[model samples]
Target: MIGFVEQLLRFASHIPTFHLNVQLLVDFAATCEAQLDRWGILEDVDIAIHYISEIVTNTSNGDHDKLQLALSSLYRERAIYFGALDDLKSATEHGPKPQALNDTKHTSWPSKAIHAGRTYLAHGILLKDTVKAQGYLNKATDLFEKVIAIGSGNIALLVYVCESLAWMCELGHDAGAEPRLRRHLGSYLLTDILDQQNNPRVSTGKHIGRIGFCYLCLFKKGSNQKDLENSIKYYNIVMNSKAIDKRHPCRCALLIGLGHAYLYKKQDKWAAHCFKTATLLEFAIPALRMDACFSWAKVPNIDLVEVYSNALKIAPQLAGLEYALSHRVDNAKLLKNLVQEATKAAIAGNDISLALMWAEQGRGIIVAQMLQLRIMFTHPGIPIIQHKEPELADSLRRATTSLHQLDALMGTMDVKSTRKLHRDGVRWNHLVRKIRASEKAQLGDFLCLSIEKILQLGRKRIIVIINAHGDGWDALMIRKGDNRPQHISLPTSNERFSSLRKDLFNAGLRERRSGDGASGTTGSDNTSKVKGRAVKKIGAQPPPPPTPDSILKIILVQLWNEVVHPILQELGISVSTILP
Candidate 1:
């Protein structure tokens, strides 16, 4: 029965309804355990469970994909076991009689257990069930505590286990266990990243910041002073590493994590100092900087506006013509919070035009990726290049496809994945530069619209860009003579535009929409973004708050009077008809 349930779980995870099915499986397993207890063989179940585990281990052999699946196997299996045990404890009307002394131990379980525990840890952190989340987290802590002790200090075993744990920590679980295993995991990771003369391998610093997170998680759980110190210690060390001291993608996460550790340790001044240093790092992603700013604002007497203003000032960088549509989407979502803060700051400073530019950058990520950029080789606009340089076009088409497919992944990268991503990023940039350099390509500007270019677009006619901010609306108008954008606070709010960034991205326009007032401002929210919320069935819930035709129209009419009418009036343009 245990083996059958485990196999069922392995298959179930690949399906959409796995969570819905888990409770039923847990109940069924409990019933089977109750029957086993009646036969005085309930305690032998652990042996059967581990026996199947050995078969799985032997089957996985040396395949990496198989290894992760094995980890996922243990993860789901233990969750089932724990659920069944809970069923027994519930004293349900009819439930399993689980054996009291249930030990989940076996040789070579350390690495497998840690891997599975990490997946469970990610799922737990993301789960909305606070009670259930905490329950599984405790189970994981106990599981890690038990298995980490069994393995002797083989450096390979220690390094693999430590790498898994550090990345798991970076996945941001609200879990910290007793200090011993965490320190062991973090210490091994730090061993590789710290400044050392004898170590032949140069650290890319990709996974090094994760070590700080491992120790931070430890400090959270046990309140161990040394764990917090070690977290800070490695954070500083990793930051100062020759690789990280300069601009590096890894620095994005490191500064944020370090800020948190300092916050926890009451080193408020050092934490604030991180914000200044982060601001100096030209390449650090804006979204990450926003997070650091929020954390720094926790210090008493600090100006809140000043902190978020820093987030606002960090401009969104172009994704370059080579970036995947999905990558551009990811980058935009990351920049959203900072854009929001920046917009608010603009409102405070009465710099309406500046806020609009920031909002333009934040919304319509795909729009930004394609518009103002020359067409791809397939597009008719680039026919001359495609026909003349057919071979180059083919190379570009293939390389561009490979680059997009490579960077679209949405999970943690081990060292191998990190190297792969870096290579693809490099290769794609090289190809783009090569294409641009070719005289025959005639691409002109294969890039997103520059702020100056966008302003120039408004020289001939009026262009009003409206963006939804929280529950309100703000607008920027560009007229011919006054090259600078003019701001208008629209009279009404429409929630549909709140997700304008996402909707415009999903639209992914085939042709850039032009000759419009507030172009790309009113992205259609025809699709829904439930975002893990339960989807309602037909007639399942009351009618939604009056949407598109009603609230949206009202907002539009409000814009006509408050924004367009005034601009046109100022321009001496006549309106033939008047509206109430």
Candidate 2:
């Protein structure tokens, strides 16, 4: 068959008639598509698309067979193989020739239904048009019912139908029909039970993982104990099943689902075990490992803060990892609460030095270091920045600068320029890593000052920390010579800050409108006000008291009034002596 197709291509250039030449190219493209369908050759399918485009362009509108071939090449073969909907779209642009041809053909009802079902499945899954996908799937189901009514004993056709329908059901999940679709999924999976187990082709890891995922989806859809049990059963079947490819990405997800099931079942030990095992999967991507580690950290039975800490180190800078965590984890609280708990643990063990080291290894390393500096500088007798080990401070400053550079590279590298500077980034990363490791080893625990140690170094004064987050701020206080850190709730919330900013923005808009309204009066004050508003509107400078520094000053006074002054008063300090 391959040789015959090659011969057709070889003779094409020798044909004299332009019409015949175009027909030969069409034939060649159809042959290549047939080869692709037979052998699943993606590269051949790509080549076929190019040829089909050429023929469809040159062939006249009345060339039904050529157009039909092009449509089939795109809608059926190429779209399915490549998962790119552009060809399907192009095929649609060529009219419904392929669908018309399929209707006229003498193929079996089951065959036609499965083919149509697959085309719709590709459209739905790839194009993300849930409504169109679902509508076509319904049409496919009716056709499949007719095929079954004809008493066809085709196991392959039945399995294909079941698989397509199962996928549509899964797709409907994101469209918010999860519970209803999951109830129907069991029947579809049952249709392929024999094939899934005994048919060697159907028993591959990918198929098994899909079946497992259906159950996992159901598990997530329900809160009952039975849902958890079923999820665990199916996931275990996939995990423990023989001859399945362990390196597949779906296996990572399957493991994560299994871990979540165990967690819901109150099997904390099992859940932790599953998550840790998922993290160790050699083939799993870093994003998957990041999730596994984050989930593992949330399990109360495990004290693997170091594992969570390390996972967090790379999570924020990686876009996909950050997105995944944003959906499933309270990342801000996770880091803050973890820090607080680590600090308490260290205090309990009388090893505050270890707590400081832990900070440098995790998500808030830079922030923790800055806070440490604040604690040190606020001490009455502590030496100034330059005087406190000048060489070490300089090295730290350089390391901090390199860290900032690394962040910029991670956040801003365009795809076109990445290749050019890829080697440079790697070298910079290696150098930075080496420097940090050396600093940690040489400075040991003292690289980060323990609150107790810092407070003891100077005059007896209390150190207060206000950690701001997206949702709210956390305040921690440590008196000089105190062991335990005191947690205080801040008066300001994210909502309040956001509301304040919004009001200020509205006021700016109002001022700009007022300035514009008065500008035409032709007075100097009005002209000056209009000019000032224009400057502020254009971001030349913020309008007067609404500047960032002014906002900060306002917030500082409010904080002192609401929390700081009250604490000082409680500690026997005169509130009148303190200036806000």
lDDT of 1: 0.52
Question: What is candidate 2's lDDT per residue for 1-580, written digit by digit as tens?
Answer: 4456445543543563434445655566667665544333333444445435544655565475455545564556655543445666754455343455356345534454554545555566565555677765655555554565566535444434444555555565334445434444445545365234532331344445555555555555555566567667666767765443444434556688788878878899899888887765533444566678778888985776555444544343232111222322444444555555554444345444444444333435434433433343344322333364465445545544544454467668675334323333323232322333343334322333343464464246675555455545545555665655555456666676677677667666766876667753233422334443532123255445464455556666766776677667655577674454
lDDT of 2: 0.51
Writing each residue's lDDT as its tens digit, candidate 1 over 272-390 gives 77765675454444345555666766766666556755554443333433333344456567566556666766666876656666667666544543342224544553566578778
Instruction: Find the candidate with the highest TM-score and give its number.
Output: 1
Residue 302 in model 1: lDDT? 64
Model 1 steric clash pairs:
none
Candidate 2: where is the Cα deviation over 4 Å?
1-203, 216-231, 241-248, 263-266, 293-317, 320-415, 418-466, 469-472, 475-492, 512-518, 522-553, 559-580
lDDT of each: 0.52, 0.51
Error of 1 at 288 (Å): 5.1
Superposed Cα deviation of residue 113, candidate 1 (Å): 2.0
Residue 434 lDDT in model 1?
Answer: 49
Model 2 is weakest, by summed lDDT over 10 consecutive residues, at: 319-328
